[model samples]
Target: EQGHEERKSGTLSEPQEFHSGFIRINPDHPDRVLHQDIDNIENIRSFISAARAAAFSKPVIAIKTGKTAAGALAAEIHTGGKQSSDAVYDALFQRAGMLRVSDLTELFAATQTLAMHPKLLKVEQLTILTNGGGPGVMAVDSLLQSSGKLAQLSEETRAALNKVIPQSDMTSNPVDIFGDSVPARYQQALEILLHAKEVKNLLIIHTPSALAPSEDYALIIAQTLDKLPKMARPYVITNFMGEDAAYAARRLCSNYGIPTYRTPEGAVRAFMHLVSYRRNQKHLTQTPESNADDAKINKHAAKALVNEFLAEQQSYLSTHQASQILAHYGVECIQTEVAYTPTEAKEQAIELGFPVALKLISPSIPSKSEVGGVVLNLNDAQEVEQTAFAMLLRIKNTYPDAIIEGFSLQKMAPRAGANELRIAVKTEPNFGPVILLGEAGTGLEFAQAAVALPPLNMNLAKYLIAAAHDKGVLKERVLPEKVDKYRLCALLTRISQLVIDQPDITSLELNPILASNGQFLVLDATMTLSRYQVQSHRKRLSIRPYPIELVKQVTLKNNTLATLRPIKPEDEQAHQEFDQSLSKEDRYKRFFGELPQFNHDQLAKMTQIDYDREMAFIITQDNATLGVSRVLMDPDKIHAEFAIVVRSNCQGLGLGSLLMRAAIEYCQSQSVQFIEGITLPENTGMIELARKLGFKISRDFEEGSINMVLALTPIDKHG
Candidate 1:
């Protein structure tokens, strides 16, 4: 059971549970266990749900390998076609907040580190503690290799370290305590490292030596960590050298929740997982600005275009048709007209004045540039007709099998910036529709693109657009204004939404996307649709998008019209004001204590919720937050803790009742078994509200609180 032993257990090995988990990273266990029940979907769902529930206590990682011919056969024979596509698995893991790694080494290291310090979210730098110089250098090399940073010792920290270990022999970042070290000396260094603000992670490396206090060294570190407060303790991992001298030391470290790796590389890699976790979680909560109208798409018009193309038995859209689709969704595209004859090409080219481009549009040829099917800078009608005739002859000679539909006459748009970018939505065999951002065309062959999942909001869209910034292509802005990053981000978000709305679309590409003075336009596009209906058991998307469909209007008992919708990331500022507007008494009634005001971190947590298992609905009259109803679901998916609060002025206006009904309906729809909450015993209004909402109310004398429980449905146990 390599890397299978639970880090929480003190022992080296424990009795392995056959139903331990879906450990996809384990290649040693090569045999794929085939569950016999083919149609027992409930059984599989219950099992997966339970596994996800366990993962909530810590991060869970999985790697799905073997998608080739032989591997697919093994999978099909094992599961009897019960295995949903890997895209569904990605969505499932995202909903669970599980980190999906690509290798076994990463899986074990990340799992061990997270288990040791669940609250250790991010690592800016590491305070390395070591005995020998060689081992110290090894630790530093590993950390830097994993993209880890070394904390610079402040003057005060340097002075303290000098006092603990003589400055003559000390290294800067690694803070070497010399080859012959004692437990007392290590403790002194530990005190200085822990108090230093520059360090967020700690790595201790010690090579086996007769002079080293091997057993006492681990014991001292453990005892010191036990005394420090939870928040004060940084992420700590130790490399205790050899098996002979480090056995007892390893046990002591494990017992105290310290991850002990046998090698420096392993320890540093484990710490990097903490860094990755922090970065990913922060991105998840970031709420960038976006207009409400930005998401509004012409669904009817887009659908009609797709229907027309499919009716003609065409699997792919022409450049003209693709541009039309982009226009319907408010995306700017180069003007294009399909020219049937050389005369038609001359006519459209004349209307464009000058500097037009001609592209051969064919059902069989998706990439026209590949076969010299495009010609630019046709300044006059004569050139347009001449190039159009030559283009037809060349296509016949070069690509004889390519079905030449018609030639597209497009206006040659000028550029604001010299750079050309490509944005695409291509279905991956494993991750479903992945957004690709890079330098468009043949240039992107060697230059890697930034890839992300679909259903992106503004924040994620920004992340994808800025992906090429590190490659030095984005900085060469020739225009007076810098690249309109927000506009570019909005474009990616629109494309993401388009793909989510249209599942039959297998691939969409926008090559040589031009951006000038904050304006963006697509020069060319090609899209393909699936011929047969997709028959995966999973939905089109794993990550749930913004619930615009969930928005509803309701008239209160006072005849006051109120609109309710799921909370958005942009609601952080409004939420802060809502908190301040609450009276002291009302705050105590709602939060179980006085919350004078929510800090920035508190505000972000309330605004940016992972909508898969959590949801908050707010009622507004005129864009002001009037009341909020929220639910925090248990990982089990059966139980949820729900609460609602209305503004003091809005109370007693039937707002609370409306919110309560919505919460119950939401819980029932999600298959939540029950909802429960606790409030102060003195809060009679809440007790009355609960009783009216069909909740069983009871007083807890021991805790001096009122308990309310509402059973929505029964859990379906696997039979």
Candidate 2:
């Protein structure tokens, strides 16, 4: 409509209209001249911008047609240039935040599902309803094909649904109503399923057949949906029909606020997309803090380099330059030096220490190993010289006209059991700066190992790291006897931010990220640059002094003063003082066991921990630290642990109870799981505090303290 007005007034430039129902791009005429005047890049950009804006406001879905060249040519004849048209449309639509549908059926389903339930609060739980076994099977197949899930029904939901369905019918998720189901039965089944506590969203499949009246079923479904509460749940309905029944079912479902699709596959795809978007939204709302130091480090290094690269208009940086960038981001890369000659290679190898790796450095070749440009485990000067010469010769033979800049001498890192970690950035038209992390091996690429699109935040970064496969490996086995999980998590967090902040990055490949001996290092790296490459910018979030007024309100003992405050990262010295004040026995009891020094990882986890579910508080009087308390919650909110470490000198002063009281109050406010604590049976001080706090104590094995449990009750308002 806007385009029509602009065209009539001769004010609009290159008017294009999207299909009303399916958001597919179609130019005004099919047969047209293939030139900039007809279909220019600017027009494409405008189209993309419009689509993206619509998607942001409401869910915009697209179905792309014309896969074969012939089909494309036909489309072009009806529109403009075939090949260019498809490419341009795809690039534009993707940027505009429209989900591309593979087929007509998929397109319909995606639009229908998205239109009905545009947003999701949770993605893990799903419920399905189908009338016939054949359609149910097809729905299951489509789900698997599109990576959609057939969620396992919770026991409670299963029991509830079973009450309304026959015993012969499948009671699990994807509840098949069978051929005998009538309008009344269908409505009752839907009501019971919707009311289940575990079902977050639902997918209904209604296949009109000879026996069942499809329109009648659709009417019943509509009536049931109308009776459901606004927040009961959202559902996608798919009706497989031939002409008359399909049209009737689609119109009926659409009229009643239900998104209707013609096929099951389309519905599943759209549902999965909704699920993903919901997950991202939840993550964005949860993670609030940004690491300023990491930003500063990256900015200081990226600015000058980005400026130089942009000035030269270089699409990619040399290995040496790339290494500098990695170092700036605090990523550990192999020890490397650019050597102009064999002698230089030997010299650099010796300087870097023995057992070095030699590689031919060429601007043209990105994958050195594939081209036989890499030589590993070259010990001594002679080995380095020979390997460097051989590598250079191999490069020369592989590409006779290739430019051989020089050789790179790098110290070979110890071969430890490690995984390939590739962090790449791919810009989607609608979604900006997607950071991908996966295992580096062929299997990872094949499996598409756990991908998370965390929206450029440190907390999301941490969550991504925790979700990765390497996290399990680090927790269960990584070496140095006790690998620093916190430090590794921080590294992942920093890497995510680096990719998000740096726009000049076209693609980055880091293979064989070795996690060994309590540290991680990058063995090889390749960083590609985009045409619009520019230096990265630093991000800073304002920080103010801790609120003193709020801290003073928290008190200990009869009128004794205690300060509440925010902790600084540089408080390691004071932390040590607080630690040393505890008896060896007390320290062991608190830490499980501890004798070594606290590393940066430990400090970061303690000081920069997320304040949402976990928090650390210190009780102090006149600048003298009395004790520290920490509240930890399980991810599922099923349980919480409160651990307090008080100074031996301050034990009997009721400081432990003060910290415990604060932790309990916090847990109750968060509506967290049960508050639990463990104390040595002999630690009568802690036991007494628990008893005074009205906790239910339970004694376990005699090896240590009795386990204490506290059930929080709402504080009385009118006491």
- Please give, for residues 428-535, the per-residue lDDT of candidate 1 as tens digits: 542456677776674332135666566677777776565456444345556565667787777777787777667777888888788776777788888888743654
Per-residue lDDT of 1-719 in model 2, one digit per residue for the tens?
A: 00111121111224243311112222332211111112222233234433433343344455555656777666567665423434334333433445565665544444445444555546555577887777777778877765456777778767776777887348877898777777777888888777776667788887776666688777877777777777766554455445676777777776676766666665666567676445433332332233424443565466567667767776665556576777777777876688899989999888999788787777687667778788788878998888777777777777988877787777877665543355544543222344455555432331253344422334445555555543332134454354345655566656555654565676666665776666777776667666543322311111111222225345556666677543434445577678777788887777667676566545554654444336677776766677888887764455788888888776666678777777777677666759998877777777888898888888877655588898776443110
Every model's TM-score: 0.78, 0.55
**Compared to the true structure, candidate 2 yields what TM-score?**
0.55
Measured over all alpha carbons after superposition, the RMSD of each candidate to the real structure, in angstroms, is 6.8, 17.8
Itemize residue pairs with steric clashes in candidate 2.
Answer: 30-77, 30-78, 30-79, 52-96, 95-429, 95-430, 420-440, 679-705, 680-705, 681-705
lDDT of 2: 0.59
